[model samples]
Structure formats: structure tokens, C-alpha cells
Target: MLVQNSLSEVLRAREELFTRTIWTDPTSQLQNRVKGSELSRYFLLTESERIGIEQTIRLLVSTTPYYLSLSDPTDPNCPIRRMIVPTAEEAVFSLEESSDPLDEERLSPVRGLTHMYPNRVLLFSNHSCSVYCRHCMRGRKVSSSGERMEKADLETAFDYIRNHHEVEDVVVSGGDPLNLADARLEWILHELNQIPHVRICRLGTRNPVTLPFRITDELCKIIERYNDDNLSIFCHTQFNHPKECTKEAKDAILRLLKVGVSVGNQAVLLKGINDDEEIMLTLHKKLLEMRVRAYYLYDPELIPGSRGFRTPLARGIEIVEYMRGKIGGMGIPHFVNDLPGGGGKITIGANWYLGYYPKTRQHAFRSAVTKKIHFSFEPVGSDKESYYPVLSEADWEKFQAE
Candidate 1:
């Protein structure tokens, strides 16, 4: 368990490790974030690469100095740089890609509240982030114009949740909920606590990865206040690469854990970023060490300008299969794809269950350890019965008797 004293020690050492001026202040960190084209000041880019990034600025390009400090300025192929810096490939779009790939807007009954799942709803609290990820599925809204949820908007969303008694889960997301002021975030949590039906409130933010300074003691206190038996609060963050699991990021996660707020990572499988098996294994292992559970390894969504970052669906399965026995079960995340057109998330994995053969009265499975096919016969006198395979007359008679 992380104590306050240890966290203070980490914060004090930040200056030694990172020369950034705003390592302790969240507001200063945001104010100093490098915006589009400004990224070249921190990272070295060729003339063509610079032009390509400028062209894709329509999607918004922003990164905190702390995050930028992690990149290799000389290496354009650096995984950390590839995530925040846009490329010419983003300009090339397929007909299958969409601005609202998840169909979030179509499912949204209110201005910012999307009620896609029966018992859950996603609330867009604001339109700002510490860093604008190039592969964001919500590229249409996030970091577009610095719009935020006003009091009226919050009330409307709150009213919607109140009316719908079936809504047990409310996901407070936006550009990133942590970007919201502490008072506002507390108000949002308080409102949800009032709703008898609402039992779970999830704050979806990438601040922990991009801007760990945002997870202050004050913020954790607000989270601890409302997080109780009645309303459980969980922070769902995205950490795509192993480099993101820095000491600061781990300390941020520890702060949340110290407050009884569970932290989980939902990493997207990017083509050149974290598609490798070893990279993912190391990331999950680090997350477990920080007491953050590995939640979902998402297959990249079919969002506009994101084809450059997306990997084949099969690639995600292969990574999951490779990591199964290598890591603890808790460290392994569910590999899932959030279907386009808001069809919702569905878990996908390697076909370990080959098939069931009635002819042999057995089930076939591919062994994870041996990487070979194996079979197990159906138990006799099971409550559920299937057509048994043909056998010798004596054997058939014995089977029937059993």
C-alpha cells in the first residue's frame, strides 16, 4: 500500500528526473501543454513529417510537456511520439471509417448522455483533455473547441439518470472527466449518489497516463468521499505502451488505490505502438505491480483518421493467447472489440475450443501449454444429454444402463 509520505517523496524527486517546471500543478501542466505544430519544438521532425502533422491538425494535436519529455526527439518511430504526433497516413481514410464510429451520437438521447447499454449510460462532461490522442474514437468532439458541460447540461443528464431507474452504472467521460474542476467532479458524483438506482460511477480519463499530476491528494479525497458501499467509483484509464508506466504514473495509480478507488487500464491494440506480445506482457505486469488491474485490451475502433494506428483483429487475439499463462489471470485483460454502429463490446479470443464431436461423444480443445489438440469424453449420466457416438452393441447397452 502507498502511504502519503512515499507519494510526497516521489513528487519531491520529480524535479531531479524531469526538468519540467509544472510537475506538481495540474493547471500549470495543462496551460503549458504543447499544441499542434508546437510539438516540433519538443520533437525533431522532417519537413514532410511536419507538413503531414500540420495537415492532420483538424483532429487536434496536444500533449503535456511531461508526456513529451518521455519521447525520443531523434527517433520518429518512437512509440511515445507516434501516439501524440499525427502523420500523413491520417489524411488517408477508408469508406468504412467514420467520425462517430461507435455511433455514440445516434444512441445519445440527450445532448451529451449516451444510453447505449440498458443499465449503463455515458456522460460527456466536457470537451477537453491534457493531451489529444490522434487515435481517439471521439475525434468529432474531444478537444475540438474547449466546450464543457454547463450546469444545465449536467442537470439534464442527472434528470435523465433519475428518470431511468434501470440505470445502475454511469460513466462520467468527456475529453476526460479528470480535466473537470474538483468542485464540479464532486458535484457530479454527489448527484449520482442521490440516485437510488445508480450503484456504480466510472470516471473515464487518460490523465493518469498523460498527466499524472492531475491525480492530486485533493482529487483523491473527493473520490474517496463519494466512493462507498452505495456508489462504487472506478477510474478507467488508457495506457497503450510500456513506457507510459513511469514512476509518476504508478504513483498516481497508487494515490487512487490509497483512497479505495479501483484503477483499471483499457489499452487499445495499435499497429506499431503496442501490438507486440512482449510489450503488452511488460505493461500488464507493471500495472499489476502498481495494484491496477488489467481490464480490457480493445481492438481499435473504426474511427476516422485512425487506420494508421489500428491493428488486425487477429493480432489482438494472438497477444492475448501468448500472455495467458505467462501472466497472472488478474493481469490478463479481456480482449474485446467495441462493434461499430454502437453494437457494443464483445469479447474476442483465440478459438481454443476446437469443437464438440457427437460422433465421439467428446469435446475437443487446443491445449494452451502443449499447443496441441486434446479431447475429453462426455461424462455419463449428466443432467444435459447429447446424442452419443455409435459403439459396439455391448458398449451401447452399458452406456444406456449408466
Candidate 2:
């Protein structure tokens, strides 16, 4: 287990890695908020990567909604409290946990591109970020898959995109496309720009958060080379803890922004990590300041050994409620979960009753009209059962029985 010493130790550690000037007014206020440790300055993603951002700091927060249960705030037994601060048990649970939880190979078409969705395609390559995450959903493919996306695969994917006129958008992602050499990435971008039907090109990478150095001046220039009215880059950067956002990471993010890339962050709402309301609020605030739009704040999946990382729906809802009116609408991210059985990603957002409010239904019945209510509303709750709709329960049961 990692020891929790006084905030002084954290500050001292920060002083060692980063110069004192980095810890200016705004940073010092944040540091004072999380009194125990100087988490942001010290927790580097991987040894080779630059030290993390010096501004992020974790705090004692909760996931319980203000409308729901807020009592007994300190125990992990509570759904909202389970992962506020991860224990050593949670971090090093076991190695048997499969890394590639999605098993995306089942959805691959020809090469590199995965035509999982009808209108969209995923370009999977061997590029990776600065560090390998222990709880990475694609853990299975990163190190051992030995599957480098060859030129043939890129051509096949591009060909598929061209043939399928319905495919109006393409998301270029891999372990981390930024990890690919600048020349190779430029080649891919150049090819995609030629496809007239392809209206948008989105690049999914985490270099801005993991290995900020990858976003060099040359890389920025290549990305800018393809940036026009139609082509825009989509970054799926993850930041589980506030401390992970370092000055170097910030610099990397600015480079992409300078080049006109549409930057967005996709953070997984881990149990003991940044599951607290204060921590989440601060992180979101920082993202907006840095010009990064906060995307999905996901609930960790129950992949083989990922139980320790999973948080209940209520915990996630609690955090949302806390930040709803408190912060700007743009700062809030929709909570989501990628369901099992290769179902597409779905957002778990605050409940907006599409059919009818209970009172509305009751009043309608009183008026003597028995009519079917047909309304489609998006859900933002904790129920896993409703996460996916690709197959109905009956259909799944039928398939299983067969």
C-alpha cells in the first residue's frame, strides 16, 4: 500500500521535481485544499515520460448525490465511497485480469479499421501513450498483441471507408496514434484527406495526458496540415487523478490547440481515484481553463479483475448532481458505461423522463384516456441493465438458449 504522509511531504517532493515557480498562486490554493499529499507534482505516468502537471490535487469527496444518501460518508461499503481513495489492495489486485476487455478483434473488417458502427469506423494501430495504464480497457492488445498496423491494413481501412458511402465520419485511433512516427501519421492523414465522402477525421489519442512530449512542433504541423472546415481531430485523453495534469501535459495540450485540433477528454470515474465531488469539480474546471472539453466520465467496467475499480451508478450520479448547477453546463461531462457483449458505448446521464412523469401519467389516467406513451428519453442513472439496447433481454436469452 502507498503510504499517506502529511501534505508537507507532498510539497517537498513537488519542490524536488518541479521548480517553485510552477506552484504559483492558483496552484498553491489547490495544494492547500488537499492537505495530505502533493499528488500532482510527484505521480508520473511512466518513468520515461515528463513529470505530471503540477496543478491537479485530490481531496476527500463523495459520490453520493445531495438528494440521495449522504450519511456515513467515510466507509468504502457505500457505493459512493468505495473508491474515493484507492487502497493498495485495489491497485495490485492481480495480473490475471485480461487487458483487452473489449475483444475488438471480433469486430474487425479488413485491416486497422473496425466497422463496429454502421456509419463510423475505428482505425486501430499499434501506437501507444507514454505509460501503460493498469486499468486500461485495451490492456490485452497494447504490449503483447504484437499487431502493428501495416500499410496494407491502412489501405484496406481507407478502401472500406471510400466504398461505404454511408460512412461520413472516421475516428483514427490505436494504442495511441501519436506514438506512431510523425511521417507515418502524416501519410495516413494525407491519404484520408483525399477521400471526398469522408467528411470528418477524428484522431483518438492520449498523448496529451500520458506522454505530452509526443505532441511535438513537427507533429502539430502535420495535424494542422489536414485541418480544414471538414477535418477535425478528436482526442480521447484520460486523467483519473488531478495530479496527472502537469505543466508538460498542459504544454502538449496547447500545442494541439494552437494547431486547431478539437480537443476533448474522456476520463474514467474510478472508485478510489477522482471519485470525489471536489476532486471531480476541480478537474473539470481545469479542463475548461485549458480549453479541453470534458467528455465522458465513465464507470469502470467489470472486466475479469476490474471489480476493485468499478463504482455503483449512484456514486456517479452523486457527483453529477453536486456539479450540475454549481458549475457551467459545458464543464459537466455525461457519465457513461460501455456495456458487455460488444454493444456500443452509451451515456449514463441524469434522468430526463421522456415518457411521462409519474404525476403526469396519473393525471392523464384521471382524464379517462388510455393511450400508449411513446417517448424516447436518454437515461443517466446507475442501472447496468439499461446501458445497451443493441439486443433486447428476450433476444439475448433466446440466443443463449440456442
Candidate 3:
């Protein structure tokens, strides 16, 4: 709820930023995206770099003008460029990598709908993105075709959700859910809002980072409309590094928060992008400043052609361990690994619990922040009250007066 000003101010400022650039048309940014070999025209790529990119281009290669402007054309190792541009390393596949590492297709109850958990389901709203990330886990599905969910497909998914009362959460994701037309997106929200049993609807998108212009007043109005006492709406976006926390990105996040939409970030721990503890900490801290919660810091999935981005499991643990007390708890995201082969997600972090002694009824723990050992004695059976402090009559009387 940071920027509670009028929507016109936000739009005017956004337009001013792009007034002299080719990205003046906010709505057409997606359609005007640069792709594949066309990248050479925008960035000053050397001959070797151009060939390397062309050779390693397997997944769809595209980036919005807004995102492309964030990169340093001369630096090949620029984090922004590394995310959207392919390198020769992408062609080198590892034995453990799989296109569908999570086995989402096998676990799908209906086409485009993956009912992985009992209470929640993932709905693929579209198969397009303004910027096709090089380390995308769903590289096989996303950006393969510029397809949106048809009415029939949506009805089938809706029917499944309606039939299963146990499902209270629905995650509308895709290459990017915001990529869909405003009317189309509104329709999906409307249908989901009609579901009486559904309590939470989360829109998974990276627009705030990749295409801030997409978060228009009209889109926010649609989001605000569906949000009510019956159902709550939340937006989960990706922002891997502090550089991505631009003024435009902050405005977009504030716009969502200004409405009733709860905004959160799910940063991926990429090798060359945000593997460093300092970088990750800065990214999360910036997100907190924008009124966005740091939700998850994901360990990169074993997606094909993503070996260059993946870091050793120990690296993620080390980064999270380093961030323990540097910032507030709200800025620290849960380090998690979405297990491959449909095993599901599990939290991965430094272990705090040391051991427990039966005879002494004591539990030992190591502080992640202070790096000190502490012990706590459990109360005897049916005597939990003994563990709490007892106030004297005089102390109780003084507390009441206060």
C-alpha cells in the first residue's frame, strides 16, 4: 500500500520514461519483442558471442524492449543479459536434466491443470511471455506456441475445480498469466471468483520485473474487482537480483498493493545471477521496501539446457544460512527445492535442531543468527504450567495499574 496516489500519475510517469524510446506503446510491447537473431540489432554482440547464442538457442528466445534496455550491451556477463540471452553452455546437456523434471504432465488431472496438491491446483492460463527466460523450468511448454486457454479448455478446468470441494486454492500461472488480454484475463478471474469453495486465487507472473508496463490501471481494476471477502487475490512474481528492482518495477508492485492484491516475490537462485549471499540479501531487502514479501528462494530445477544456471545444492543452503539475521524475518524467503519427478517441494536450509535428551528432558538447538548453542528443558507430564513464570501478588497489582 505504498503509493496510494491516483492511477494517472503512475501511467504518466511510465509514459514519460518511454516517450523517446520505441517502448512508448505499453500494450504492444509484447508483440514488438525482439527474438532470436534479431537480438544482434539491439545489443552489440561480438561475432563469437553471436554464434554462441545462435548455436545454443533451443527454447524460444525473446525479450521485451523494456527488459532489453536494462542490459549492458558491452558486457556479456551482465546479469540481466544472462537471464534473457542464451550462451553456448546451454547446448551442453547433463545426464540428470529432463525437459519435464517435475513430471507436471504425468500428474495433471486435466489438460493444462496440474492437481499436484490436495488443496491447490495450477492452471496454465497462457503459453507466452514478454521475455522468455533462459533458465525457465517449463521451457518445453512455455513459449513453444503462442496459445491461450480456449473457452472449452477453461470450462473443463473449471468443472474439475467445482467438482472437487477440497480445492480451496488455485494458482493461475503460465509462460505469464498477465500476457493474456485484459478481457480474457478478467474472464478467467470472473470464473474463478464464481467458485464458492475457492478461497485463494494467486496469479503467478514475472511482469513486474520483465514488463512493468503490463501492470496498467485497467488490469489493476480487474484484479480489484474479483477480490472480495469470499476470495482473496495474490500476485507472485520473480525478481532474481537487486538490479531488477527498478523504479518501474517498484511502481508496478505498489500498484498491485494499492489495490487489494497481496504481492510477493519468488526469486530463483541462479548460478551467475544471484548465487552470492550479498546479492540475494539485497534483492529481498529491496522487495520488502516496495511492500512485497519475500516468499520463496527456489533452488534451480534440473531443466534441460539449464546446467549453466544451476548451482550446487550446498550453494543455496549457504546463501540462506548467511542471510539469517542480516535482515528482518519478513525479508527472508524460505529456501526451497521443488523436487524433481513430481516428488513435491521441501524446505531446505541450515538445520537448527541439534538433539534431544530423554533422561534430562532437554532439547538443544544452535542459533542460526548468533551461532550459539541453547538448551530448553521440557516440563514434566501434565505440568506444563511449571515452565511459565509465576507473578507475585505485588507484581500483578503493578501490571494491572500500568
Candidate 4:
């Protein structure tokens, strides 16, 4: 087990961290992580720098000692440092920016429940993450004390799911589901398990990377209990850079896998962080090596105070296209844009469509791998049923059983 301490309790936990293989909170265990380093004689701090840090502190402020240690103090553009370190760049908001870029409120049936797609829904469980991520999509709500889910909200979510028969999946997300005490999380999962309509329960959390100490043996038992055949539970974690795959992080992930809860990663494509092709490739490869599947490579949202992280959509497309033949299928995730204005997740990849003409009765496509042009004439007098690979109900059941 690992232990983290507040500033005052820092010395008490030092011996445990030093002597044992267990990791201690590198930045002290407090969720509100600010102040770059010790304010000792190592380097005289300036008033201007302190003032700048204070302004950014007005927004969400948090990071683990473990996550911060991955950064290079010398380089201003260090990807990990850019992620956790607060700066005045976050204070600036563009005119086109929005608080809810996805406009999730538009799709919400209730306050905390968002039913965007017919078959899947999102349960915004709570909003107190152990560490506040700089490039979080839900920047408007995350880390704020008001983001925590209330009893009424949970009841409303259950009611919404009960009423809507079309919904088969419920994505439990918030600041981080794992941030909740094991008992509270178990109660939520137990209630969710009672709903027969909910086939899958996916928990999206960043604790495995930012705060591995939370992955206790008790929590592992809770996951294993909820992950039965009828109602399945899966965990979705975020790790932007390869450096985030630290020993403790990997151990946390392995614990989940050991309990039969499959894990997957969803990485945001940030400009100075992981926007480059090589960085993304390495991140993807590392995720698979830990036995976690690469699920989604998300495009940064145009939210207020997040212009610093946004990357060109074209750059994301190129990275996905380039990795098509290079890595194995499990290593590749959908390079997706959670399109603005409540428009769903749209995959952004190399466009294969070149051109099509009705009069000439021809269609052209540019192959992504070979970069070669291919043309074909419009089909005439073809049987629609036989042309496509259509599976019957019995065949589908057989295939699934196999």
C-alpha cells in the first residue's frame, strides 16, 4: 500500500515512502497541488512568477508528486509539465470558446444524465478528481466543488434509465469515479446492476495514472463482484503521454485486469503535449504493452480557458492515418472529434473519397496506404441483399457464441 500526506504530515510518511517499494505522493498527497518546488535556497523565487501562479490557481489546481516528477523543470515546453503546471495562459479565453462545448445540457434528460445516442448514455457521477487535468473536456465542471453528484441526481439517473428502454450502456464518468470511497462506488454499482436494461457499465477515471494509491484491494473486490455476465463493468482511463505509464500506474492497471475488469485508454490530442505523430505512436504502443486496449484518441475541445491545448484537426487525422499499417489493430484507437454543439463523436481520419460522378457513372477513391487512385462504375441490376455481407439473427447469435 502507498501513503500520501498533507504539507504538515509530509515528514511522518517519509520513512514509509523511502524504505518501502510503495510510492508516496511526490508532491505531498494533497489534491490541491501548487507551488512548483521547495521554496528553499535552491533558487530565489520572484514576485512576478508567484503572482502568475496565483492567477491560474483561481481555476482548478491539482497534481500528484508522482505525475509532477515526470516533468522537466528546465524545459518550459515539457509535455508532462505543461499538463500539470498552472500558468496565466489558462486565464485567456477566446470569443468563440464556450463553457459546455459539447452542449451536453442540450442532450441531458436530467441534470447529471446525458443520453446522446440511442443505445448509450452518460452518467456524470461526480466531479472531484484527485488531480485536475489541464486538457479535460469537461473543464467547466471538473475539479469544482459544485460538480459532485447529489442523491437526487443519482435517483434521477436511475429513473431516466428505467424509463428509457433503448439505452443499453451507461458510462459512469465525472472527476473520477475511483475518487469516491470504495463503499460509495460499490453502492452505485450495486444499484446499477439491478437495472436489467443496462448491459454495460463503463467507469471513466484517471486515478490509475494520477493517483495509484486509490486502487486498493477492497476496490478490486468491488469491481470483480459487479462484473458478472449479464451486467459487465469496464474501466476507461486516460494517459496522454508514454511517461505516464509509471511503475505504480502500471501496477494499478494490472490490479484492475486481475479482477476481470478490462481496461482501455482515452488520450486527448493536446498541442504541446501529445499532438505529434511520434509521441502518440509511443503512447499507443505503451498502453497495449500494459495489456490495456487503445480505445479513443480524442480531439481537444474549444472550451473556455483551453485554447492552449487545442490542436489542428488535420494533424490528428494524419497521425491516425500514418499508424494504420504500422501498429497492430489493438494498438490503434479511433482518432475522434467530439464535434461541437452536441454533434456526436465523429472520427477524423484520412479522407478516402476522391470524387464521384453520376453522369459518368463512376466513383474514385484515394487509397490511404498506397496513395493510389482507384475508380469503379456504379452498380446496375445488382441484388441488394446478396451484394452485402448480411448476417441473419441465428447467424449473429452463433457468431457471438463462438
TM per model?
0.89, 0.66, 0.87, 0.81
Prediction 4 TM-score vs. true:
0.81
Please give the distance, in angstroms, between residue 202's alpha carbon in candidate 3 and its true position after superposition.
Answer: 0.4
lDDT of 3 by residue, 1-402 (tens): 112223455345335444545564566677667787666555556554565476763578888879877887667779998887787777777799898888999988887899889999999888888899998888888887644567788899999999999999999999799988899899999999999999999999999999998899989999999999888999999999888999999999989998989998898999888999999989888988988898998999988778789899999889888898998988988999999988889999787765555445665667887777676777677355444444455544443354
Kindly list the per-residue Cα lDDT of model 2 for residues 150-205, writing each as its tens digit. 88878878888889988877887777777777888999888777777777788877
Per-model CA lDDT versus the true structure: 0.83, 0.58, 0.82, 0.74
User: Which is the winner by TM-score between candidate 1 and candidate 3?
Assistant: 1
Error of 1 at 311 (Å): 1.3
Instruction: Please list the residue runs of candidate 2 whose C-alpha ends up more than 4 Å from where it truly belongs after superposition.
Output: 1-103, 352-402
Clashing pairs in 1: none
Clash counts per candidate, in order, are 0, 15, 0, 2
lDDT (Cα, tens digit) per residue for candidate 4, span 1-402: 112234344433333333342345432454434334331111122343243345552247566555555665445577776776555556677898888888898898898888888899998888877777777778777877777798788888898898888889999998788877777899889888888888899999998888886787888999899889768999999999988988888889999999999999998888888888888888888888888898998988887667778877898888988777778989988999888898899877776664544444455566666766666666875434244333345544443354
Q: Please list the residue runs of candidate 3 whose C-alpha ends up more than 4 Å from where it truly belongs after superposition.
A: 1-24, 46-52, 146-148, 382-402
Stretches > 4 Å off in candidate 1: 1-20, 381-402
Show where candidate 4 strays beyond 4 Å. Answer: 1-52, 353-369, 373-380, 383-402
lDDT of 1 by residue, 1-402 (tens): 111223344344333335655577878788777776555555556554576576773368888878877887667789998888888777777788888888898998888899999999999999998988888878888876645678898899899999999999999999899998999999999999889899999999999999999999999999999998889999999998889989999999999999998999999899888999999999999889888899999998888777788888899999999998898989999999999888999999887875555555666667777776666877776644344333455644444454
Best by TM-score: 1
Worst 10 residues of 2 by lDDT: 359-368
